[model samples]
Target chain A: MIGAERVGAAAAEPSEAIRLEGVRKAFGGDEVLRGIDLSVATHEVICLIGASGSGKSTMLRCVNLLEPVDGGRILLWGEDITSPAVDVNAVRRQIGIVFQSFNLFPHMSVLRNVTLAPIRVLRMSRREADVRADELLGRFGLADKRDDYPDRLSGGQQQRVAIVRALAMQPRIMLLDEVTSALDPELVAEVLNVIRELAQAGMTMLIATHEMGFARDIASRVCFLDQGVILEQGPPQRIFTEPREERTRRFLQSIIEAGRM
Target chain B: MLGGGRAVVVSTVSTIVFFGLIAAAFLFAPGSAQVRQEFFNLHDMKVALVGDPSHGVFSVGEAFLRNIEMFLIGEVLILALALLIAVVRQLRGPVFFPLRLVAIAYTDFFRGVPLILVIYTIGFGIPALGLRVVSTQSAEVYGLAALVLSYSAYVSEVYRAGIESVHESQTAAARSLGLSQWQALRFVVLPQAVRRVIPPLLNDFISLQKDTALVAILGTVIEANRAAQIYSSYAFNYSSFVLAALMFLVLTVPLARFTDHLIARDRRRRQAGGGR
Candidate 1:
């Protein structure tokens, strides 16, 4: 059920799916993500919300070790996944990421985009990869698009296909970097519907989205990041209804007004 | 200025056509000249230089064409083999850089000098080493080696350029799809690059054909330009030079047109991209 009530006002909640400790990252002289601490637990969909340059996307990327952190540690299932000796590629295979731009390989069919990682990295046979890819496509309501190229699909369809591609990896957790932000208003619902299903299935997901409804309805906890720091973290009702920080309240109000339209 | 340009065009065309017709008529003439003399009379006092085959001839005939074909085909085969080997080495990661360096030095040294010098050095000078490029150990084989070595250098660079022009992005996308760097380069990049380089490759081939003439200075056993000069000298008739020039044109002109067609197709693709 889509919750209409204010979320930031909800009571305190505690669980951890992912944990970060003093995770610091800098690019050249400009720091993107400062020292940060966070925790997420199994079957908990955490939505990261913040203004531009808040480094919400950077935090999600670091979870997969796609971008190495300069300082600090990241733990996946309490395993120090950030260690240099860890097979980073093997770790990345277990955690899937979907980009905001829907970076589906343009040259391949939707099925190919989905099945490639499994066959190549995981050493799954083509037949098995194809079967899993088709099932995931069907799950996302994109089965009809299995033979189609990304360019041939609509924005909504492409986004669904991108989700299906990540799910085809059978990832333990999915990091969505503003999946619906690029969609037309009418098309956003279709993509959100697919995500809602994933959340219902108890898949661990860290979503960076401006869609407050998804954050409220799907995420067990919402953390508001501002300027590379978490402003406030709590249940959706607590963050939305009774945010501790003035920054969180103002940010929620801006998005609430936008969300109503 | 326009009238002057028109006059230059008309006169040039007229001169070409006039000479072209004269050369064609020589082919249909009744009296065929044969190269006849004692085969080994060159070192003896028995032969006159202009009177017989031991020295040279006036009529350009089937024998000359046959000899030219033998020399050029030998050279083409050698160059083709060298290019194939270079390409395979380049495809392999540890690009035979030392061999490439030596090949480049050989090409530069040969291409930089007059072709005649290389021919003479190979045919006359290299015998001093008691080494031969061919099992036959013939001087003509040495001359053929010079032609092949020079053409191989130019052709290798053509192949290298074609391989590099393929878009780097195409390679990257392939890598992201789980292809190794080598697989991506081989399956994606080189195919496109080869298509782009077809025109220049043909240009090198045509140039290689023309360069075969340089072997004449070595007095090789099977050589077209040498036949022309030899025949012209023996009969005291200079028209065999005209016949040899026609033979070269017959080979190059059609190839040039085919290359131009490839270039036009590449240009169309570029324009389509720009328009898009």
Candidate 2:
């Protein structure tokens, strides 16, 4: 449903869904994302796998304009989003992000959480939003939990509800930042399965995750980051099995040694 | 049966000891009867409390009624004004720098100024200047305004604490959803912040109710303490003041109990994870 209204000039330049040119971010003296360049094509799934603090989350945040980049530009549908003059809220409407902690509005019911942006930002009729929300909840096996608050749901159910919330926005792209990292080992699969279903539906997404096996199974492209740079990136098969960079190999080797992959 | 009889004897002895000490202090101590005749005249006390229409211009009861009136007005205004102050204090961008400074200055000025001084300045000083807008209003309005101004500073600080206590991740999540800064604050942050501060806010309101007596200093409004002053001066006894104290206690005790219940409920809800 996204980009449905764009019938004119801008729709023609839909080559890159999101492109980062020399993006750099820092906190105080610590550099988080440094001169990184990446492009996500329409319907492409890119998974960023790396050690903690390697800038994967920072990159996703920058693309959403959640974090101000210290340098460089981010282009969303060929528009420079990093420019100070850009309307951030308008740009953010196209990209929905889910955090590791499943930050559902604890005060709101699951249905309200899913329907809020549509009703408020998009100015959609409540009836329409509710219809869409009910469909999403039913598909996600959360229909019974619709009236329940976030705290009343399990971690996996909450995460699924959060994903459904993003889907209700009909966003062009979704950024998932280690969405399963905070879940218990047993609960991780339930959330990962939802992400897999989204990937199957050909949704464009940029995911930062520690689940190497799941990344290999679903990613169209896998990027292995070291420090603040993407040290190696390629088809998931090659990156996971025959990595070209030493850092990538060593990282995967550590993962293998830790028995996480 | 033997143990129960022993417990009853112990309880009766304790009660006798407590009452005996109180009677000795109030009725039978050396010079206590004369003291009582002067300050504990039951007939005079009743007349001052409810007021003798024939005897005084304003009875302690009328004064107490005025105090409650001021308190009710102050309570509603303080909530809105304090929340505005707290949000202004939290403004982050360079554009709001001047507003931020003004908010900080306001809190500092009001928090530092004594309540009575604020009542005097706004209550008496404003009226004396004969400003068309405010001068025509009664002193009670000015007194209510002073209480609101003074209490908002304290209440704002309490609100600020609640706002800061919400984790940064909450704001990030709200913003990530495309909610604007003010919208996020209104729909997400402030609701939680306000909930967390309700008990403390009620505590501040209790103090606000007590401070209403200070409004009597404006001289135009005869609140309960002022009635006590008038009656004591006439009778040459402090019994009227004692009567006024009883009246204030009558007003405050139920509020104190309610505050305690709210605080305890808040604690229990927190312990049980009230879906914070």
| Winning candidate number (TM-score) | 2
Best by lDDT: 2
Q: Which ranges of candidate 2 are over 4 A from the true structure?
A: A1-13, B1-28, B273-276
**Ten residues in sequence with the least summed lDDT for candidate 1 chain A:** A1-10
Q: Give lDDT per model, in order.
A: 0.71, 0.87
- Model 2 docking tier (incorrect/acceptable/medium/high): medium
What lDDT score is found at residue B135 in candidate 2?
Answer: 88
How large a fraction of the reference contact set does each model reproduce? 0.06, 0.65
| Prediction RMSDs, each to the true structure | 10.1, 3.3
Q: What DockQ do you compute for every candidate structure?
A: 0.13, 0.61
Candidate 2 is scored at a TM of 0.93
